[model samples]
Target: MLKVPDHQVAGHQAGHGHPGPLIDDSGRFYKPLQDDDRGAIEAAFYTSFSSNTRVPDHIRRFFPVFYGTKLLASDGSGQWPHLVLEDVVSGLSHPSVMDVKIGSRTWYPEASEDYIQRCFMKDRKTSSLDLGFRISGLQLYESEESGLWKPDRKLVQHLSADEVRVVLKKFVSSNSPIDPNLNPDCSFASSVYGGSSGILAQLLELKSWFEDQTIYHLNSCSVLMVYDKKKELKGESSDAKVKLIDFAHVTEGNGIIDHNFVGGTLLFDKVHLRYSYQS
Candidate 1:
């Protein structure tokens, strides 16, 4: 467990030293997730994929390796917001951190603040995917023939998770889920070729529930991937785990469920954008 001051705490003047980035793109946290709120997050990582299945550690990012909070003694300054967070993926050699955030730019940031909170705050009614506005992507599937993952050169592409999810949802909703229109980057294609469908099925579930969220990322959110070299060398079935980040622009209730705001399916077809695998 690492104690970090929230990103908002920067330049506020403090007695403690700044624990800078563990790796590049590492952000600080001045606010804690509260002791009571910790359980849900942990569960989100460990047991939250599907209500019925817990993904194996080799391929799953169910929570950080270490997660918890510690109260710091006040130094007569301001309310110290040092937060406890899991080392989301900075422990590996030359590891890759890929942020996979869900939602659209227009709807996420454009939504009013009141609506954003009400919609994003997950109660028992919301699925875990919608709660965090994130989903695991099909990052692992690449091609030697016409695809992205070559023996060299890692990739970090930009595309909306909203576009990916909605397009996939519409595709799977039809009689033929794996049709020609489906993007090769869609996890469905890989699931058909490989097995461990439990993961793909869970992702499909994420797509099905995409409409439930009223808010989404306006500026953009990231779905990050972390690499495990030792695991791969040992021939662990999986080598990476993915998680989401950058909630600065996340909004709530921008698009009502009835409207399916921003016409995601329509946008998906228009964009027709999916990139290659990373290193």
Candidate 2:
């Protein structure tokens, strides 16, 4: 891609004096927490997505499934470093948006113009969420023998609208760390990612429980803001406690493509036009 200083971005290797987040003992970033296996996953992805992407051997070997939005950073040093994230707000119309509060001070640098420029705009007012541009998730478990957290059985379960709201409230209100136990029921076990499905499908599968319900769209520009966690659930230690993450997609005349696009977009436009004509 576009050649620029790495320090100004999120996930790049700035050789030295970089003050951004560092990899922990488990080989994951501490903040915006991500698993350690992401490095290689990202490298392979970059290589395939673009001819110019350079995947560092060390990073590729270290992280197997780096999820979320990646950017470059300088870390106050001259060296450019990569900023691997767990979840970052990035799509077609917006920059990689970071929600941060630095001890009462919040810093959110504008998303890269280079990255944002790459996204396809649908028209003057609308833009497509870059389908090629991706975030990360687990693909396969390291091993069942290891028995910690493997991607082998990645599944997505749907929650009712009310259940989804509860999950969102749990995530947004809590200060506790991410609990792997926070997930849907056994019904969703079948729809997890596989060789046949795309990331969007995997994400959609995760929310299949809320079918036929009106999923409220709180923020059209950013999906990250839609999920909120419960503040009270923090002190407990239970996987069944039910934490919520936002999975807002497939709106009328919106970012993603689905089977309904052709029918839905036209119908929505007609209905709107009819109403406007009447008004």
Candidate 3:
């Protein structure tokens, strides 16, 4: 286990090397959920998704891999924010089901993806075309009464066309390569795509043909805003609220396939939103 400064010593300067009174001077303490903690978290997260049969057949193929270490120091309540793949996935999953139980219950195939199929009218009518995938988008929120973090059940809603426009516009306009939509670019997408997603924002436009709804895109982004439960507006409470996880990629150039070195897991077969457009 690696040692980091205690809470008192880690204070304001903990994340950085800045010296200040808020620095926890209690000698070196272990970073909460360091590399050693990753295995547990990964297993926990993977298991949660694996066990849940509700996950779509296509998505289950790409396993969730949690990057970085789970460093656990102490929170004031004697609890450390448990960092793990399961926690993150669970955070996105549980609240999603509670709000929108994807599949047939909420959204149907024709009502969703606008993409047209290649099969002739006769084939389309007879063939069992399974546009089976569904996306349950959710946002992580701070709990007021618990004082501990819990998924705010009310945050689920259909992605508005305007909101989608904003995310895409920001992604294309931002100077950073990292699609600020998702919290952190996945290791697979980054590893396979290339570039430092954590740094250096670059601008790119959406490749058309991908605006269909059949493909369930799950992406996250880091929230640069200040954290305040009271200030946050919920989905039901406000239509202007944004998904704080990460930025969704916006493609350009007639919306055709365009490739760039990206980070994190990109399961090209199913989840490749880079170029494949339906309809």
Candidate 4:
């Protein structure tokens, strides 16, 4: 049976008479197809990307493994098509997840004027313009029995750079109740974001690919960072994973470098650097 994912930290939710992403027992994620060009665009990107032999094997690991599409019945909404994807957090007992939307600009060059204006306004209003990335949502695992510490989406999206750093610290901290004022010890920083297999290293690998590849330009895409808090507390090695998600705004590169994505990724490197030093 397909059910709402408890681990989802961002994007639309199952409310307001609209269905959201669903996951099945087979460790597959089902994302509802949007009722616009975005759905077709995303589908095309995945279909092409999966078969394209040009993408390096190492870089391909950064994205969610695509499994094509499925028609699923919704709650009084009849049958709807959903993109089937690998559930990145499938095995984690207490997963901590964050969604960081990259790029200073989200609209494509060929986007409508109204769309460009909307994205521009939002980019300025949020930290995306200055930081080149913005935290869309996050849920830190407090405990198996205590559930997760999920803040309001609006509060997270509007956070300043300083506040974002605090949140990043909190995500790696071992503290309970998630106190904002408590100085984070960053017990999991080195393990989760520093090791050879850590998020930083994986992102750098992705950045390297973006530096040369001109196949596609990903706009408004997010890097989803996930780790198991239960494992960290148990003194296990970090099982951190970084995967790119959200391809609704992807466009053909037209043989030009995706400077926007490259710049945002570079800024992300700086953010990690600051986080490491400050902690």
Best by lDDT: 4
Q: For candidate 4, what is the TM-score?
A: 0.95
Stretches of candidate 3 off by over 4 Å are: 1-45, 48-71, 85-159, 174-279
User: Which stretches of candidate 1 lie above 4 Å from their native place?
Assistant: 1-80, 90-94, 100-203, 213-219, 254-279
lDDT of 1 by residue, 156-191 (tens): 122234444443332212122234565433333222
135 in model 4: Cα distance from truth in Å?
Answer: 0.2
**Residue 91, model 1: Cα distance from true site in angstroms:** 5.2
lDDT of 2: 0.25
TM-score of each: 0.38, 0.21, 0.22, 0.95
lDDT tens digits by residue: candidate 2, 1-279? 222221112232323453444443333342221233333433334333233234334222222234444454434643433434322212111111111000110111132454334322311111112111111121111122332121211110122224322332222222221345654221211121111241123223323322322322211111121111111123321111111121111122233322222222232123321222222
Cα lDDT tens digits for candidate 4, 1-279 = 878888888987666656689998989999988878988989999999999999999998888899999999899667888999999888775699999999988887788899999999988888888888889999998877788989899989988877777777777878764655667778888888776888788888999899999999999999999999888999997589999999999999989888888887886676753475345
Any runs in candidate 4 off by more than 4 Å, and if so which?
none
lDDT of each: 0.33, 0.25, 0.24, 0.85
Clashing pairs in 4: none
